[model samples]
Target: MKFIDEYLSDIKDKGLYRELKFFNRPQSKYTSIGNKRMLLMASNNYLDLCNDDRLKDAAEKAIHTYGVGSGGSRLTTGSYELHDQLEKKIAIFKGTEAAILFNTGYMANIGTITAIADKEWIIFSDALNHASIIDGCRLSGAKIVVYKHCDMDDLQEKIKVYKGNKRFIVTDGVFSMDGDIAPLDKIVKLAKENNILTMVDDAHGTGVLGDNGTGCVEYFNLKGQVDIQLGTLSKALASEGGFVAGTKSLVTYLRHKARSFIYSTALSPAMIAVSLCSLDIVKNEKERRVKLLENSKWFQWELRKLGFNVLESNTVIIALVIGNAEKTIKLSEKLFEKGIFISAIRPPTVPEHTSRLRITLMSSHNREELKYVLDKLKEAGMELGII
Candidate 1:
């Protein structure tokens, strides 16, 4: 009782304790979070297809065809026709020999990383990689070397210092917090030069990057250069699953050994069906991406002009640096009250003193809503003395 009370008290004192906000309806540009129906700008639905009628219909069709769940682990009785079709489609979309799906992106990253790497391998990871990657590295039993954030020279120096034949360089294709893209252009070149295999967690890159939405490798025009590319259907794909695209042998290896994949139940049939439709939507509808880019660029310019410290987010996930967790949380709550719902991101999600309001834009948002969010943000900034 004493220990629990003390920890709860400390969390309360820090103003960092979080709880769930029940979103009443479909996730859109203006939807309910908690009691307020605000201008929702904190979602990763970059193409705005989550609530699309086509995807909804696809989901319904899947439910009727395959029921609610996969019923067991994939190797057992779970691998249905839907999973096989989805896997084949994903491989074709990603230009890989094979693709494997996991229930969640976290599981995919952790399972794949931990399964492939062993004591013989050395992992050189970017400092700002997603938490899933960090945890995966820990479980991999590989000697880890942390390089400076996106610093190629530091990565090179580390690569030179290490003398392992099985050297693996892992990085997030898009740094989730700061929203800056990785130097995949540089990372790929260096990886090839050093003969080190490369793995990119393209969680934020798929369905949002590249012409075909093939992710960072395609975006950077480094398709075959990257050995492993991990993508998620949850973000821009607007579904709930993760995939690793690589050589047929690599994916086959993961299928047998990855504990998360081996033991956990497969993704629902509805999600897989919906994800297929999502891919089609991404390919056919270019307007969504155009609108998304316009919104992102406009917001970034306006936020900076308004004298807010909107960091180097060249993509969809922009951050307004509030510098303190308490202030960030307070701003988020106040914005919620005003019907402008954006989330506060804090450490260990971000580095200390870099607490921010993680403002994400969606393709479904119109110009008026974007303008309103900005104007309200201005008011909130002035009220909070951040301006």
Candidate 2:
């Protein structure tokens, strides 16, 4: 009851002990959480494809044909037909020479980043990158230099200062917490000028941006300029896995070398098959993206109109800054009682003194539901004096 217990007690005493919420139904804009239908603005299911009929059907067929699990690592008897097929489809969608799948998004980043670079190389990371990317850089055995979030000038200055012989630059295509798109075009230009390898973790950007959901690379029209495109099937794809899209040789290298892939079991057949079906839906259903954008636009405007501190958000992710940890927790509880499910994100998920109600939007949410959530958020803010 010394170090670990004392820290755990501090979290509870500060009213910051994180706990999971119960959802008793399928994922959607509005779902049953403990028998009460609640507006869901917390899930990472961006395109609302989790309940898409085609994806579910494809997964069912995969289960029947290929069974539930891959049973072994990809190199050790787990490279089933579905896994290969999913990788091929993803590569085609992302306009990459090839792609490789991992059991989770975390593994995809961790494995690929660590395997590709060596101790002699330096990794330039963004300050606001997701945890997976941060950990991946740490595992790479490369000298890491963190640039200011989305500040190209800072990046340029660092490139001038760093003394590494081989340089790798990495950033999230979209900042998850702040909900701002990375300047991929600018980043690419800088990386090219400095002769640095570029990689983007487009986990939140894919399926929600670019032409036909190709992600930030497509958005920037730098299809092959970046060295690697790291993404997750779990978010926009509405499946439960992750993959890396890159040159054919890079993928081949990862297949043999990435420890996470070499050591872990393969992703399930159903998930891979479902991802294939999900990507197809993304290609055809442009209207879903339109709807999602409309929701984000309207909500961002509404949050600002309501005088909430919403940062530069242009996607499904929105935030109402309630900087105090205790206040953010209280606001979240109030919203939950009002039948809205949101997450109270605090340090170190985000930086300290920036605790907030991290509201995420979905394609399934209609105008009225969005309005309802906005209204509740306003009322809760006023009552709690959070705004």
Cα lDDT tens digits, model 2, 1-387, are 599899999999876688877777888777887778888898899888788888889989999998887888888888888788888999999899999988888998999888977788899999999999889888888889999999999999999999665898999998888889899899999888888889999989899887677888888899889899989999988999888998999999998998998999888888888888888889999898888988898889989998899887777788778898899998888888988989999988999899988888888889888888888988988998866
What would you estimate as the lDDT of candidate 2?
0.88
Question: Roughly what TM-score does model 2 have, to 2 decimal places?
Answer: 0.98
- Model 2 steric clash pairs: none
Tens digit of per-residue lDDT, candidate 1, span 62-85:
999889988999999888888999
- Model 2 ranges with Cα > 4 A deviation: none
- Model 1: residue 181 alpha-carbon error in angstroms: 0.6
Question: Which pairs, if any, clash in model 1?
Answer: 38-339
Q: Number of backbone collisions per candidate, in order?
A: 1, 0
